[model samples]
Target: MLVKSLNVLILIVLLPFFVKAQTCGITNIALGKPVTVSAEQQYHVGADAVDGNVSSGWFAPGDNNYIYVDLGQSYNICKIKIIWQTDGRGKDYKAQVSTDATNWTDIFSRTNNNASTDSFTVNGTGRYVRILIATRVNNWASIEMSELEIYNSLAGNTRPSVSMTLPANNASFFSGANIKLTALANDPNGSISKVEFYQGLEKLGEVLQAPYTFTWANVQAGTYSLRAKAYDNQNADSLSLPVTIIVNPSTRWSLLGNQGTNPDSVFLGTTDNKRLVFKTNNAERMTILSDGFVGIGTSTKPNAETKFAVNGAVYAKKLKITQTGWADYVFNDDYRLPALSEVEKYIKSHKHLPGVPTTAEVEKNGTDVGEIQALLLKKIEELTLYIIEQNKKIEEQQRKISELENKEVNRN
Candidate 1:
């Protein structure tokens, strides 16, 4: 009996040191580590809970007071241990968890609690945990505790990080063409599943393949905030920094020329707001006026008779004319064939061909190749008819002369 009493006394002396606060299947990952703790008000300071000093801890100000903690990263939490002050026991308390700090879910809650040190079994997994005290003992207006400890196993997951590469920040472009957007993403511990692109809050598109890219075509003129979101195989996601871009309504363009020479460029016309003006070395090369008249080498509006006006020569291998009437009518039987004498008279008076332009006219206004070819064909057909008539007259005269000679021979 004396030996058994000695063993019992030793057990009673060492019981506090051997107390197993929780029976979680995992290890205590939150012990003596740096954590972010906050409260409505601190008795001394809330950081003392994770400071590993059991003698010092946090004291919240009022009923419904709460103590929140962030484990720095996500973890698979299994249990929590709360060490209260000798005089600070709570009647009601609850525990909660969250992946993000804002949203939370209750893992455990208790009522009518009276204990200096309390242990709660929690089946929670998150990066943040909080304790809410609904009521405290002695009808105290505030809730008090000496320490807050969380027992957890690391979740072993990492979210992917992403960034936009194309349409660089503050870049500008025209409204009509396609804009190619590109993004680069990285996942340290896993493979990337997809990348989603967005403009402001609206999701534009998604890409699943490598070299993640998307083309936004014919985007209207406006300011846009472009971003990309990357998702990993573990369903963890992260967003990239936004890129601001501007799309102009009207397009300013240029056509490059050889080195040391001026390029042909286009811009909105100063005189007419709707017109597009083309320039070479800052001189007017061509103008597409507001009236839809296109002029080359001049900005003067084209006259009523001209649809297209050019101030230079044009060389073409072939000229196709789609006229409604053609020179084939000159070959008709009923067509009038003018006398050669009449053509001569007209040429002498006009100082030119019967229907062709004079030298002075040709020098002043360029010739139409198609029109000249058709007129020459008409004259050739007329000449052929005149030759046939003359041949007929010659044949008649030869027959008459032959008859006369034969008659003379008979008389002899």
Candidate 2:
């Protein structure tokens, strides 16, 4: 919170001077770079002095000490800014430049410096610079500074580079879908201020972090060209190469991958020899053949003799079968009924009624209920006729016997 408030204050104080700052052509040569300090402490690393943030600092516990910064290469620096901690501002310090560590040339010195920030004008050309501390505001051994900035008024900055990374080149998507725009950016001599995303000439949004991304939602169907613009701290900007994408209108059905010379009919089952099988639980549960024969619980091809086949039993509330004739014809006078003796001989040989399937045949291929019912009804009608004939024969024999008895009595 404190650092944020300080940053806000710094911006407010510095914004008015931004117009003048640009003409100075000044850039921080020490920000976020390597440095060396005489004192060794975890919280007092020399890198903190050039870290660019005012909330953190380098601390040396002893007076008469110094911190060194390596610019990586030589630069003609003209000015330097020293930002100090409010708790322990350095009372006296001196800035120096050197080509080697052993020798140094002093540029500026100060005493009783009570301000939180101090600036100095210096003319120097070296790869290494140092700040030697003489005393603290309280005359204690402690020396602390939040940041150090070196500037060159004659140097010119370069534009940063930006590039889009997502929604790849020449990609396609569905209409009204959310599209994500992403980019990466870098500045060679300064920090990236912001990256702005664009569609054609119109701006979409901006992001400041790496893996920088933005979501564009519910875009209408059309072809679009996208790009990103990145700005550096120096206000110089650069634009990325554009990426093109096409969005098609929404539809109920779509095909994935390439569809070329598609099948005449797409089926949800396998086909072999013009027989298709539907499956459930990884097992074949139904089948249909090219000739329109259907089967359940099996995939075997049905022949002309048997149009429909089922491997499992079926259950229904009621069933009806249409036939050309029925057992009612058995009562017709012209209908030939087999003799009872003949039926008895056939049953003994076949182990079943003359016209019915044997037990072995029923076990192998199952029974036809309609055929069985018809056969049994015919047999019952034939049995009724046989009983009538037997009754007539017995009656005739009894009547003849009675006559014979009467005649004998008469003779007596």
Candidate 3:
């Protein structure tokens, strides 16, 4: 009976110390939270520290490495635990707490620590918790940690939910266009504080009230990932799934009038060596080649020798042809007109007039309208000359006849 009473008294005396040595059943508040680090290796990211997995870890070379986690809201921090990797451990380190993540207050610190794991009680209240490794054990240059557990002495709070509502995923836009970003945010147990819009990691703008919206103006051409972050009244934040968008170059002419344009710089053609096609009713009507050849109503390539080709007939009210020379030179005094007999002989041999194309030739190679018209005029002037000569001869014969008749009458 005496030994039992003594054992019970000793147990009562050490119960308070045992309770103080360990965490008071508080839940870890840093699990799966957003983690930031000063530097990290390629595969060992900062998120590994608060991911609740002790196999994978964050690795940063060089001493004075630091990492932090956002608890999503303010908490009465009660304890902290750090599990180090087998080969990497901190020689001197400290724990800090911050409400805004800018200013920090030291809660616990140790020097010349050689333990593989460290657990300690702390009295602080903050939404952000940080661990700074001042030096590595064994004078090493790298420090690695597997897990960092932070315990809070308060109940868990619901995080705000957010989602992007405008500019659907994989959307496209022209460069220099204003992109309107809209988000729908809700908090189950509290009111929303603000919603911030981001393009990748760049914050575009923020909205503090309902109907969260922001306009990002004059965005340049590129592929971008956009998201929204919503914060509740308790400062707990949640990120929306990213929306990807593409911004294409805008070097196009609009139907409306344009200003500040340079005629020499502006063009309506392809930059590459490809044909520019014009379509009407989903049918190709015309095409302009890279070499400046144009085809109308023709799918086949335009003839290389011609500048413009039309597959069908063309009608115009008036057509003009500019020629270097005309048939007026046919009336020159030095001109030697072909004899009628010689022209007849040539026509009989060739089955066509001199200096004119044959029927077969005209069918194979189209005629030049100006050249053919000039040849026709030259033939007309030559015929007129021939008629004049014949008339002169007839007049002479009639004069002679009249003179002879007069002489005969006188003799009678």
Candidate 4:
């Protein structure tokens, strides 16, 4: 009876260890490890199965295809998980382990697998783990797996650490700007193989060597979540904390200096329906309305009827005025030339010259310089015509007087 009781006590003492040996932790030892395959399709190489990304995987087309992973060294593998791609699962397969890779020993086998994902508690100790497929699900000729995770009951590889160094969190930039992304990555027990930069789920770029950097150019305007993922030489990877950034419209100009700017694309204006104001000495110097009217030396909105409004005088070396029509039409034959008597009557009654703006009109609505110049030219042309007519009359009178003199001399 004492022997029986001692045996029961001994079994209880080893119960916890046995339970621990049957289950494996979450760490996947097969990740980032070197892999080999009998045959692989494009973009579905054997390395994809251990890339730590379940979305990407390996695919081989034909019967009796197999893929194997090298864990770098042997481990006490306790769990094997296979996530099969839809419609591309292996119906008959075997999970095998090997020390020399040439001689393999099957730890688990399955026939007519209907599950898309399968996990098995395996008792194996080897440097390599392989999966051999004899037939595909639904009698398909291709076999594919999204992930093949091998968990070691013993200690395994450590994942690399990564952090973004450039473009600090919450940083802002202009659209179409070239942003340099940098990352600092290191492996605890191995060496870094590559660092990939991602904006959300989309990968921007990657660098294989040290001083990892990528230039993301011509990024559109939007809010983005950025991160860096570092993969070690063993294929184990870890992501840095996400960094959020803001990309504003490229129309914004810096008060400092700007480089690599296209003059045609640069603008100083408002994006919305608001007026843009310029100031000097804490006072408004210029204002531009949303409708394109400009004002100088004033704060109030410019006159809508006029394209430009100024409260102060303007100084320019030269000024130009464009007119749709000129007073040269005054010389047209169809134009009636008013008599001088009619012009005198108009000036006397209206207190201004004919076709000229009155003082009150000029003060209230302002004068158009082009219109005034045209009117003055028209008056000068009319005065020239009057002087020519008077000269002709005087010549006619002189001719008559000379004729009379000639007649008198002849008669005498």
Q: Which candidate is the best by TM-score?
A: 4
lDDT of 2 at 281: 90
lDDT of 3 at 294: 87
For model 4, residues 32-145, the per-residue Cα lDDT tens digits are 999999999998999999998889999999679999999999988889999999899999999999999999999999998999999989989999999999999887768888
Q: lDDT per residue, candidate 1, 1-412, as tens digits?
A: 9999999999999986676343343335555555444453535666776667777776766577777787788876778888887676678989998899789999999898888889977788788888878888887755667778888743455679899999899998765558899999999977888999999999999999679999987777788999999998766799999999998664454353122211233343445457677888999888776777788877776456555677778678986776545588888989999887998899888977687888887887757767877888888888888899889989999999999999999999
Off by over 4 Å in 3: 1-250, 299-305, 408-412
Give the per-residue lDDT digits (tens) of candidate 2, residues 264-300. 3433434555777678899888778777678887667
Higher-TM-score candidate of 1 and 2: 2
Any residue pairs clashing in model 1, and if so which?
A: none
Better by lDDT, candidate 3 or 2: 3
CA shift of 29, model 4, Å: 42
lDDT scores of the candidates, listed in order: 0.77, 0.81, 0.87, 0.87
Error of 3 at 28 (Å): 72
Q: Candidate 3 clashing pairs?
A: none
Regions more than 4 Å wrong, model 4: 1-178, 181-253, 257-275, 300-304
Preferred candidate (TM-score higher): 2 or 4 = 4
Taking all chains together, each candidate's TM-score versus the true structure is 0.38, 0.40, 0.38, 0.41
Model 3 Cα shift for residue 64 (angstroms) = 98
